[model samples]
Target: MTAETAPLLELRDVGKDYGSVIALDGISTTVRAGEVTCVLGDNGAGKSTLIKILAGVHRADRGQLLLDGRPADFGSPREALDAGIATVYQDLAMIPLMAIWRNFFLGAEPTRGRGPFRRFDAARAKDVTRRELAAMGIDIRDPDQPVGTLSGGERQSVAIARAVHFGARVLILDEPTSALGVKQAGVVLRYVAQARDRGVGVVLITHNPHHAHPVGDRFLVLNRGRSLGSFPKADVSRDELTRLMAGGAELDQLAHELERPAT
Candidate 1:
């Protein structure tokens, strides 16, 4: 990874609004290869809005979206995929009854043969899925197992592997650990690191500072549709991050209000 190169994806002064409601305002950040950029904020902090724009679900109203140092405007999620940007939402879009290997390939299946005789290569799919997951430190007992049979963390890892396998240069994870327990969230965070090590620019969107602190290379804090600013890991601490996310004034006031009830 070139430490000084331009970001793989960047949003410059990007923003979105719906009539009178400003969903996101003056947001800017860079996602560089081989690093995790955590977008942290509480509910209603424009996190979802930011994810939508990055995933190409909505166009930015006020700024430029750059890819590889050139301006890029993705018309749809498919266009974003073609541009090597892949998004993994919390729901995961997986079929519970489908085998893990099948879910891994989902819409883009490996195929072989000519014209009408072409068929999905199940063997290659299973083998590649197992190999990739194992490389990410995930050990699956069997590829034929149903996706629903896997734990939350394992499922997230599979989605990530699929993205990386299909040529995604940048990965956007939307609240990957929101519904997970501590142990499971840790598992997902490890894969986030794995993706970084494998040279994928990762955008981790979540409200939990603890989860972000351990794996993030940089932090971008958002609040009520505005960006506080971007901070590198070395520039900020977990407690400071948590306070910013919760609103420093609000936290301080709450702390004082709850202080011993001073009888």
Candidate 2:
């Protein structure tokens, strides 16, 4: 929130191109610790491109990305993870039939014993999973419960908790609240607040202003692959944020046209 506090992740005039298409142009925003920076956009508004760039799925074609006030170049998502940037995608990368602990430590599993005897520390995994989820204010009857059995919001909480536990300094959430019911969305938003409270910078991408406005400390609006602008929550109202994401005058014109009868 303060200029004294450096951004955990920063984009300066970042751009991405696909063949002849410009997915993003001169987009810039900052994700600061203890803050949720929400990226709001409609379909095809460059949100996906921006997330890919942040997640290291695609490299930016222009400008710079800074991490911890130093220039950073990430070749792949694994590299990004090594740099403490973790992405919790919409699908959440969870296996439906797997137990919560297994899904929690899917790729990065704990091991014990000699090489040939090495095995996943199942006991530690389940215990850590249970403990971490509880720390996030999540109460699960069983760590062995299949992740699919949890509600949408609870699954999100698990993903978030895992990222935080694994030392992710920056959390990139793609459309976190999109498919959830109102109450469920609120539950996830609260955990988002919890992450920020624990000093993890968050880049929350979503199309819903109501979902974003409540937890976001900064709002970035994108339209047709270009940034409208990034505003501090203090500088932008929820209604205005919603209105701008609707494309403002363009939406008004479309509404007027819809009201007119066909000739």
Candidate 3:
């Protein structure tokens, strides 16, 4: 691949096992900068396992993880974070009672003073939070507002903007829109596109093909811990993706079996 289109993160035949159970097997995909790579799969499709591996919450039993064309093995979540890989899970890891700026810089808060005089730079944190959110096209009237006051979609967008602000090159979103309404989900997808426009490689994990197809440059479909196949947007239609995610031939057979006998 050319330097412009080279993968920021890549998985080569990656597999993971939990005792006798194989959670993932021979899964391969790539996440290029300024592009969204959607991982579409139904329940029990090993999506969680894959996320854990990518986020360093769990290690792969086999295969390779490449970061910026170099082999990488993240031993823990901190390691992955330090490597510029950030994950925004559904829960978002935010404190509802906390202010927006506080949540934005939770663990990595900015400090202004030194030695015994050291203290959190609340003003700088709030200012930077405001600017970052505005840069991402997220309009928050007040950075002092509690995170609990924002809508589900807004919460998701904040998480995305926070990742971008923290210099995350590879952002992994786990089921970002699964619990949202259609309009709300669209809001999250818009930010996903915005992040792509900003040259971030995004891994969007979702079960919805409709949500995945629109903004995704590539799609990786998984079923029962195995890949159905990986296809570029040019190679796969939304209908086909939906079918694959719904069990493809298995779904067709169920429809056939459920059909009436010439009634």
Candidate 4:
């Protein structure tokens, strides 16, 4: 892609401060359509601050957020959703007890008939939900089954499919695989690729370099509320990314400390 093809979402010199504490400083990144931009960090690496800014849960004190080459300011989560930017946190905002179809259209439901006489279109909603999930290669045994019955990876897949079906141009997924087993995490990663293949800009936030390396086109590494570096996948190897995120200096110090004789 060239500079003329602006990113679907861009954060320029973004900073977030809470009273006396600064969560991020001059952080900048971009998420392009048909690509996965992985944001890698250890705990307290300003990942939360960056996502909150993108999701409109918090506003930046400085810098600009541009969507499709236009300055964007999302006053609230709803406003962000209205702009076709959907965020799926690790928890996925799903009600496990609710049926799959119900969870699929939790906040936004389809209605039939006139305004005053409008009623939930149960049949159509369930049908659409099943079809959409199937299109994403997610085979839910039954739409009426409670969401709790689905596996962690399945739930995340449903969330991604929902976002895509709802016309989301950019999908910000916060650690979608952090809580899953190896097999389950792989499932979610496949869905991440599916979303990217469908032309949605995907922002994948994770502490696992191994998980991020395969599907990511670009990688942004953060530590102690600061960005260590950002590089295209072609420019950095997976082993290199692992070493960087693991803190090469800190690891070497620990290794030396352990090998040294007792004082």
Candidate 5:
């Protein structure tokens, strides 16, 4: 798609309120086809609220959600999935004990035969699972092995590949690298790039600007439930983005406080 075209997913002036508390305030961002939009924020910076709205777990209190330039509202997670929006949370939603093929087609398994003779197509599923994983640049030695046996990064790769195979137009990844070690995080980041290369609009929600900078086309910084700023990669430097995400003023204040002499 051309740059002039509307993004695959766009949130315009989105806001969320819980009683008297505003979880997100006038937040707006876009995830374009073949681009990664990294949402950077520290704890309680409204990242969760924004992801909930995007994943259809919670509807925005106000503002418009547009998919391909048309208005959209998802009443449930199923609706969102049906609309080609897939959310791969950090938890991964996989059965650790289940085999790779089983986990790959867990909820939506393909079956063969009918009339009381229906059975899971284990062979087809395994072959397809293996091929799909390989296509996504994941090298799994065995598709029948338990998911728990796979490393964190490999499991993440499987989740992403599953979403893409299921025809996801927009991928919302919630802190995919948070729980992983440095090397594992790097592995997942490569998969994120792969997803983008496949023309999927990726929404990578994380606190690490360094992780986001390499793969992101645009960065959206949130602080105290409000958007600090959103800028294209070309417009913002890595250091500036890091400082914004780290809350520069707060960090300076803390530094000053620590530097004060003891009473």
Candidate 6:
């Protein structure tokens, strides 16, 4: 495919195993710039395994991982970050007592001065943090405030903004809205769209089809380490996606089993 049409990241028949336990099997998907691809599955459905593989924490044994249509084998998470794939886990690695700007530039703090005289450029860090958060539609009146003071959704948004600022080509978000309330969850989804609009391909991993359907361009459903299917939004309605995610026949069985007997 041409450069413009090529997916930012592609996985072909990818599979992984822990001894004899297959965690993923023949899984295939693609993440394109300016779009969100949601991976939906219940716990034990291999979602964590998938994230580990994509984040370079583990290598897929049976498939090809292509970046810009070229095969890639990442040796470590650092390698994945260097290659423009950034994964934001549920527990954001921010220091609760640290200032927002300090957390923003955490490990990669900008330095000023020379040799022994060099020190963290606090002014530049604060300015950039404010600008970047504003760009993401996050208004923080005081970036000097402790990050722990921010709400969960705000924390998630800050993580996303940080990824975007650091040049993440493919953003993998692991259940960002899982612990959030209805309103807070909405806040995080908004930033997910913002990232996509900025031409960063986003892979949103979640079990909630409700959250995934609204912002997703495509969906890949997994169950027990296997793919139910990959579908475009046009091909799958929100209700249909919900049904598939809820385990179709199994859900039906559950409902029937829970029904009260007629008097």
Candidate 4 per-residue lDDT over residues 156-197, each given as its tens digit = 999999999999999999999999999999999999999999
TM-score of each: 0.95, 0.96, 0.96, 0.96, 0.95, 0.95
lDDT of 1 by residue, 1-263 (tens): 46579899888999999899998999998999999999999999999889888888998899999999999998899899889999998985578899999999988889999799999999999999999888888879999999899888888888888888888999999999999999999888988888898899999999999999999988999999999999989999999999999999999999999899757
Overall lDDT per candidate, in order of appearance: 0.91, 0.93, 0.93, 0.91, 0.92, 0.93
Pairs that collide in candidate 6 are none
Off by over 4 Å in 4: 260-263
- Residue lDDT tens for model 6, 41-89: 9989999999999999999999999999999999899999999999888
Candidate 6 — number of clashing residue pairs?
0
lDDT pick, better of 1 and 5: 5
Question: By the lDDT metric, which is better: model 4 or model 6?
Answer: 6
Give model 6's TM-score versus the native structure. 0.95
Clash number for every model?
Answer: 0, 0, 0, 0, 0, 0
Candidate 2, superposed: residue stretches over 4 Å from native: 260-263
What tens-digit string does per-residue lDDT give for candidate 5 at 158-249? 99999999989999999999989999999999999999999999999999988999999999999989998889999998899888988998
> At residue 51, what lDDT does model 3 achieve?
97
* Greater-lDDT candidate between 3 and 4: 3
Candidate 2 per-residue lDDT, tens place, 201-233, comes to 999999999999989999999999999999998
Give per-residue lDDT, candidate 2, residue 225: 92
Decoy 4 TM-score against native? 0.96
